[model samples]
Target chain A: MDKFTVLSAVAAPLPEENIDTDKIIPARFLKTTKRTGLGVHAFDSMRYRADGSENPDFVLNQEPYRKAEILITYDNLGCGSSREHAPWALLDFGIRCVIAPSFADIFHNNCFKNGILPIVLPHDVCTQLMEDARMGGNARLTIDLPRQVVVRPDGTEVPFNVDPLRKKLLLEGLDDIGQTLQHEKEITTFEERRAQAQPWIPRIVLD
Target chain B: MAPRTLFDKIWDSHVVETLPDKTAILYIDRHLVHEVTSPQAFEGLRMSGRRLRHPDATIAVVDHNVPTSDRTQPIEEAESRNQIETLERNVKEFGVPYFPLLSARQGIVHVVGPEQGISLPGMTIVCGDSHTSTHGAMGALAFGIGTSEVEHVMATQTILQKPAKNMKVVVEGQVGPGVTAKDIMLAIIGHIGTAGGTGHVIEFAGSAIRELDMAGRMTICNMSIEAGARAGLVAPDETTFEYVRGRPFAPKGEAFDEAVAYWKTLAADEGAHYDRVVELRAEDITPVLTWGTSPETVIPVTGTVPDPASEADPGKRAQMQRMLDYMGLEAGQKIAGTPVDVVFIGSCTNSRIEDLRAAAAIAAGRKVAEGVRAMIVPGSGIVKAQAEEEGLDKVFLEAGFEWREAGCSMCLGMNPDRLTPGQRCASTSNRNFEGRQGPGGRTHLLSPAMAAAAAVTGCLTDVRELI
Candidate 1:
């Protein structure tokens, strides 16, 4: 998981904007403790017809893109309710990066925290990329996680930005909990101050 | 140097400490919890072996993941059952008050909080959900936090965070016919991009806000989180005090008078200063319908789908094109009467008695469109029971719509209810993200009455016009 290497072939195309998290992984899937294997149920509705057969019309069913690691999407990606499962499912499905025009504030932040690089480009750029991916399964895109550069097959590069702090944490694989632990000394100091300031409160311990 | 606004006063007073990293340690006065996000925080606590530092300050309710179709069985789905059970266990273990499914007061946290007088002026409330900001309408500072932060607040009644700049949005003039607080909010978000409220605590004042009822004020404040603001607030005035005077949690008699006197002090001074001020005329506001994705994608019902080229700002135009392509929407199309296959009229956004009454007025003696699947999911079991008692359920069913039990139903793709793939819906829910209702499902946000109108007319139609 730390290495975060992904292939170009497993990419999928979301035809619409605001691809919400619930759609990526339904709420039922959230019951499980384990985040892995969500890929099997990812886009379950799109993958299955009313008769439960594979819908070839869906982008995931198309050849070559079936195993792609990058997903090309339109603007306002992940626009619905803030469900963390959306990013969890995307990561579970082997997608390390998503190229889109824009993203919802919460979902975009959630994706970054969970180790997915949400690449926001201009609309024309996204359209061009989506068209490229659709024209052939041979089209490839690479997101160098460490470098934060989205490298297109045509040698065109889109330089994306991330919060400097979040970028550092992502490269080091630290979540909010992990980042808090990094400031363990400061937290302890604060806790000590709190203990004295509010002596009536019990010292609650957590692992 | 100047008279402080309620927003500035609240922002300054709550800052316990400011860190080098720019996060402020703000004290929390109240914390509300629901079934979904509370479980993990509770587990995190037990794993760490910590007792809730001050359980009395926190309250828990089971709202999400409850069955909307049936009141009994703790929900048929095992996972939903487990989610509810987990809450019961956590509340028991944590010593927090719990409002279970059948409780008479059980409702959306926002509705339940203000109605019960648990949300009070000058209180800093936090919940594990975004709409937590709805409490801001009472001159309280409230916001949504994550699971880890939930645990943090449970252990310590204070949150470590950054303070926000103050934004005053003055909504002036009288509202037009059929315009509600929902339309005002939708109009606000449409004018300012979703991120417009980023890093600001928006304080709504002016004639329009002052004229709104407490319930209507809540509807406006509820969607403040949707506008990317950390929170939105209204000063405690007569309307605010009257709404809370007789609630279960409010103090009685002279105690209430004392509390009201104290609440009045929390309002902004006569010459309050604001970092940013936005003025909107209420008369100019109209019923809104979302044409594309995102809550900010909303527009006046009289408008058309914005053409990318029509946008003068090149960057904005570029962004619009991206959103359009991703949403699979064509530019320059009229938003009204766009075909819809589903109509949902309940959620935390618009599931109060007022929301139900508004939608029912539109649905009365009318039939829902043929072959269109329309459902009304009450936000809480208590609301559902009240609606049924008043025969609102019959009104909904008479309109060819299904009246379901309380839970977050079609607003999200949770529970058994969902929009079929490729189907479009005019939803009263907050978000209009693609596939938010179901896979390949298209959602267009509208007011409850608008949703009801769409259900009857079989498309995104304005109710005020139909009337």
Candidate 2:
């Protein structure tokens, strides 16, 4: 996981609501065993035409926005599926932060695990950010993690809230698995106690 | 002491250690794995030189990309075949118990879990699919995790987590005929928008919820994710106990009695506090379906398509307009009479034997309307065998609905079954998202009975009228 501190980059605006994981990276592209190289397939359905050419109408297909590191969208962004590939695709495609009024629960957590920042802002604030995004290259947004604010191109700062622990993890780029492993003894003790209290909760012995 | 919710009790019992910020290292009792999500997790474990901490507690199956047609033949899609083969090799190397495509028990991971009693009361279950919430019907703390979390569980048998606030969705009174659990869930999602249950765990209660069978309860909990909640719970009771009693992997004799005793105590205590409460009358919930791409874009079967012009918010109006265009529906058109090209009656949401029976009852002695291709893909080999024994397959086959083998099939369209561009479908699957059934496939989510009604009428027909 890459450490996320402060990033200043162009943000792409997708003004739709409930842009689900299926649309982010279709199930067809989910067959890969490895996580890398999904950037080209990000938003596969909308990004490309049926003949495999770029769909000029898509925001990501446009100039300057093609290299966007932040995304601004409407409510309930990433609303369906628990597929981690959604975030993987976004990260691979250079999107590091997503600003929305709200997000689906699984996708929100998936974003953090993959080092993509999913920032929930007020609806009006997100609308403003989307407008700023529409200005293209000249309107680069700066996300300051330590200060917990999104700095606009006009030099205005809008603060946001994130879980303190998750915020720390992102700033440090710490491995969660490594952090949890430090309590290996406690996990072992819990397993032993659970075994005695509920012996039937072990393996599923199929006939 | 304050009263604890069922979710609280299960969560507290599973805590291995609590951090200062309320995040806990939670011990997972079961980890369900599928082809699409587990391969990368396994790859991560291999790359890190980590051994699976508890392979016995994990179970793997192939569903999403498996061909639902003949299992004897080779998988034609090269990428899909490689993915399945990758899982087969990974599970073998990792020593996890697996139900391969040819196994009699192989099916959708959610269905396979409960059917084999792998998901039990008072356990914490995690899978890489959002529908893992379906196991919450067993009085478990089950939710979906990302591939990173999957790898975490594989290496440590635990996950990092924070407790969600409690929410109670109380649906009172009994549903009338033609109204099923699927209808109740759709109605609930409609009442609460797609993001309504975010950051909370919903405990579905009240008289109507109690009246539902185990299968019905699973259907309700299964779509909690669709409502933006990580998990949904229905406290375990006699109904849940009865369903688990004879399952192959369930405990035997004295151990079963012991388990039931503990399970009986897993319900929310009296005077339990909830962060929020949403109430509904089951009798008021008629046969309902999704008219647009989102699950929240639902209305009763008798309602007309909504006009975006009536929406107060401009952003929402534009979104509605886009959905209306994609759905090819007029602003004020009646939803009931809309024609459909396909009818699908299977998925983790509605692929159990009970769902099959409900659809077969409607299909009995009724011919599928011309130009409508309907298919019934049973949830698993066990479900298929059970349906056949009850002659539900005969009823569906005679009614012109193709009786297919188990797997996800048209649900996610990763397999051979799919819809072409601009094909409208009446489906029993959980999601109605854009291209969820296939690229350019338009899906209308409904109950199995409703789907069958659509198949026979060649349009979206109310099951009440058909009955």
Candidate 3:
């Protein structure tokens, strides 16, 4: 994972609300163990027609939006499924920041873990961003995590707040597993005490 | 100190270490794994040269990818076969207790966990699948985790979690006959909207919730995720104890009694404070049907589709318009008698034996309407055999319903059983997302009895009418 400090990229506006994980990447595409090829199938049903031709009217299928790296959507984005494939697909599709009014908790957490910045702005601000995103390829939105601001193509900055820990992790490119391992000693002590209290639980050795 | 809610008690007890930022390394007592999410987590562990910290604490099962038809035949979908095969290989290599495809113990991870007694009162349980909240019916503090967090739990039997806010949904009054837990759940979600419980774990309390059987309780908790809640729970009581008494992993005799003594204290204290509270009258609950994409886009079977023109918020009105357009339903149209192309009566939600019996009772002596494709996939191999022992399968098969093997079939359509494009289905599954069953498929989430009623009528029909 690369450290996510700042990046400037074209913004694509998907103005719909409740764009669920199933819509982000349908369940059928989740069959693969590997994560790389999912970007092509990201919105499988909506992006492609029954005959496998691109749905020209869909947002991502349009000319400048095909190269979008920031997605500005509406309320409750990533509202269903715990599949990390949702973010994998978004990252694979070159979407680094997803600005929405709100996000489902699990999907939001998964995004941070996978190096995607899920920005939760106010409804009005999200609307503003969505409108700005409509500028297509010319709108190069810059997301600066360290500065906590999203710079629009016109040079105006919209400030955002992120959990200090999450921002630190994102900037350092650290996943939760790496941070959790730092508490190994405390965890081992807790387990030892727990095993004493609950004798029914079996112990396993790493050989 | 403030009076602690049941959620606070369980969560606080599980905390191994709480960091300055409020993230706690919560010890997981039981970790449930399935085909779709665990493969990559296992791959992560292998790549990092770390072994499972506590293999015994974890249970693996094949459910999501397995075919519900033709058990003996090789899975035709290559990718689906590889997913299941990868799980088998990973579980074998990791030495975790596993329930392979068609094995008696194999089933939906959510169902098998509680049935096998791996889920118990006061335990912290998690799975890579969101519906892990199903185990919370056992009075456990359970929620779903992503693949990366799954690997965290696999390696340490712990995952870092921030505590969730507590919301108490207290239901009073007696539920009417033919109304089940599913109806109550749908009524709740319909009232609260899809994102109502986003940051909270809901405790379903009061006389109405306590009255439901274990299976009914499970059904309610299973869909908590659909309401955007982390989990839902009912306090452990006699019904819970009786259900767990002699299961494969339940404690025996003296141990059981001691466990029961502790479990009694797992309920919320009289003066416990909840961050949020909602009250409902059980008698008000009716057979619910989702007319549109989201679970929150639900209405009573007797009610009409919501008119977007009636919505005050412009954004919400547009959202409603999109939903109505996609569903091919007119505003103000009645939900009942809306034609259904298919009916699916199985999933982690409403796939227990009790759920089957309810649908079977409805299906008995009635034939599915002409042109309606109806299927009943049991939740697990054990459930399938149990349904057959009671001749439930025969009743369904005779009623023109396809009695398939145990798996998540047509619920999100990962398998061969699916609704074609533009087809509409009345399903007993949790989600009603657009294209959830298949590309351009429409789903109406309802109870098992309602689904059975839809099958017989070839439309979304109220179970009360038939009963």
Best by DockQ: 2
Model 1: CAPRI class: incorrect
Candidate 1 vs 3: which has more TM-score: 3
lDDT of 3 by residue, B31-146 (tens): 98999988889999999998998887888888888899888999999999999999999998999988888678888888888888889888999999888899889999989888
In every candidate, how many clashes are there?
12, 0, 0
Write candidate 2's Cα lDDT for B92-121 as tens digits. 999989999999999999999999988998
Task: State candidate 1's TM-score.
Answer: 0.79
| Ten-residue stretch with the least lDDT total in model 2 chain B | B243-252
Measured against the true structure, the TM-scores of the candidates, in listed sequence, are 0.79, 0.98, 0.98
lDDT of 1 at B247: 69
Error in Å for residue B89 of model 2: 0.5
Interface RMSD for each predicted structure: 6.4, 1.3, 2.8
Best TM-score among the predictions, by candidate number? 2
Choose the strongest candidate by lDDT.
2
True contacts kept of 1: 0.09
Q: Give the TM-score between model 3's chain B and the true chain B.
A: 0.99
